[model samples]
Target: MTFWFHMNGVGIGSLKVYTNDQSGSRKLAWQRVGRQGPDWNQGHVRIDTDVQQVIFMATTRFHYGSDLAIDDIVMDPNPLVLTTVSQTYPSTASQTYPSTSPPRRYLTCDFEINLCGWEQDGELQWELKRGASPDRTSGIVDDHTLLGGRQYAFFNGHKAVNSSYVARLDSGQVFFQPGVNISFWYHMNGAGIGSLKLLQRTPYGNVLSLWSRTGRQSPEWLKAEVNLPPGLYNLTFEVSAQHHFSSDIGLDDIVLSEETIS
Candidate 1:
């Protein structure tokens, strides 16, 4: 099993992992008993015992208003394999969107085709801007982003106080196979008051969130990946801002692929 962990305002705390096997007894599998800073950390363990259950616990000796968050927990029975199916990016005006229907193949945008057939909300605001500028030259959407020739769709809360935007693709367009995964690179390192989410339209017409992130994460591009089951779904990219004009977000290098357990 593997997982990501984050902590905030923590002091004199201990993180421990416990496990129980068919013997019906508990034992400590792993632990981190000490002080820690607020940051994103990851952990993994190889359970040699026939573990019946696993437990994670955090104990604080003093009351310091601490917080802990966990995400991206994967417990696959077998080591899963991944194969790339498509990498979608439209660079020219004539380049068209890839068919959304079976073998779903395409990306959201590189900001070359002017949003690349993506529909956006007017209030929240999204625009294609040069990836590199005096104020925003450090963290770009992806490694392929050029200084002046390439651009990315960004939501910089320039004139808005509290903002929200929804960018979506209609349904019945892409055919996603079973065990396929979607991924993208995002830049969310501004005022630490922005959020980004990936959602999909269910068959019954309900939007379900697959993955999400909020606040500043380091000072560079980050990657978000979600494994999806076989289905025809409409994907949506949602962005929101809180407070001032410093909230900024960027997106690029969207990819969908199949996972084969090898």
Candidate 2:
């Protein structure tokens, strides 16, 4: 099974999986998983035994800087728990909210021309381009995108101590739906050491991290999904890199809707 979580920083703890033996004694199946630095980490463990439960233990040298958050736990074929029935978002809507009283819109951004009015900031270089080239000589194309198009959010690492970029919605947007979810396509490739985080801003100016992943997830574009409570919220997309000039990260097709998949 594979699980995703936000470690925030290094030296946190470990997650253990356990199962019962034939003698009815509890035995450890797998143990000790952690991510380096402050970012999200995806962990995978193969259990030969019939797993019973999982446990998380903090090491003796624990530094309580950031809390651990886990989400989107997945196995190859299926999952342990189901969250939603289906996943759908209205892509054609111009505005993020519905014209009616109850609010019925699915916000979308393809990065064609920055029509969505998203804000950008931080150290890592971010821009909209047709696509990135995968080459070593030019040192430009660190990774290839899964979605082929005329434009996508291309995040490139530069020669700097800190490398990061943030794309977010401006504050004070009203969302009246009972349930809402945010989804996007991201391609984190190459030999870079960085992390991507999906954050939500509340009405009281509080920022809450909902989902994240670190390092090279895959060569192809991967979908990241997160559920939000019914209320007003501002979304922020953040990518940070530790090593300079490692590789490039690509983001495209962002959607916010009242749908999810279990």
Candidate 3:
């Protein structure tokens, strides 16, 4: 059995699953007795013998504000095989179910032909340009998509009247499952570089700041990744300039895919 669960404010409470048969009852799974955030997490359990019933229960010592939720429970007759994948960042090891599961790519954009589905949301817009930015001192010298051949999105800091001037690129509503991977290449070069923020706006009008980077980075493009939770949300890439021509920022090769499990 496989399912998705979210736990919140469970200070001393525990969530458990059990399988019962003619032989007896056995605990199948249980969550740590602590507070887990709103992030959706995957759970799996295997039953070897014939089971008459499956049960999910929550027990708590303090019942004031504890919350435990579960969803997307799937029971397959076929046996499931688990595999381990080595990861350098985020964690040292990760688990993947069903070794044949392949990552599903949801979106991929190079900004070579157009902005794809991305839209300009603020007054200071993201411009599609090739090679260096207008000022040539800040921003990327070549697009990360094709080195010197293709185009990329650039925010011209030269036009900013003040340091508060922001350029926003928004990806309209998209559906994402739990544990999706969002990645992109960004260039923040120049003496006057400012800040870049990645935000997630939910359907209920709640906005969450996922990631942010301030100040100037390396002259070459750098990669960034965000592990997004399950939801239908809009993604916003916001850049604020330092009111200098060299404060420009560049973004390229945006991609979103299911978390790779190998």
Q: For candidate 2, what is the lDDT?
A: 0.54
lDDT digits (tens) for residues 98-192 of candidate 2: 23221122236676654243533343335666645442433233223434555777666553466544333322234535556667888776676
What lDDT is reached at residue 206 by model 2? 88
Consecutive 10-residue window with the lowest summed lDDT within model 3: 97-106
- Candidate 1 Cα RMSD (Å): 17.8
TM-score of 2: 0.52
What's the ranking of the predictions by TM-score, best on top? Answer: 3, 2, 1
- Clashing pairs counted in every model: 6, 3, 0
Each model's lDDT: 0.57, 0.54, 0.69
lDDT score for residue 192 of model 1: 37
lDDT of 3 by residue, 16-113 (tens): 77788778766543333445455765555544447877888877667766777889998866532122234445654564432222122213678765
For candidate 2, the clash count comes to 3
Per-residue lDDT over 1-262 for candidate 1, one digit per residue giving the tens place of the 0 to 100 score: 5566655454546666678899988876545433334556555443433799989888776677556666787674532122233554676444333334322322434555444334443344466666452235333444344445676666665545545543333222233556667667787766634678777865456788888888777567677778875565556687776645556677766766554333
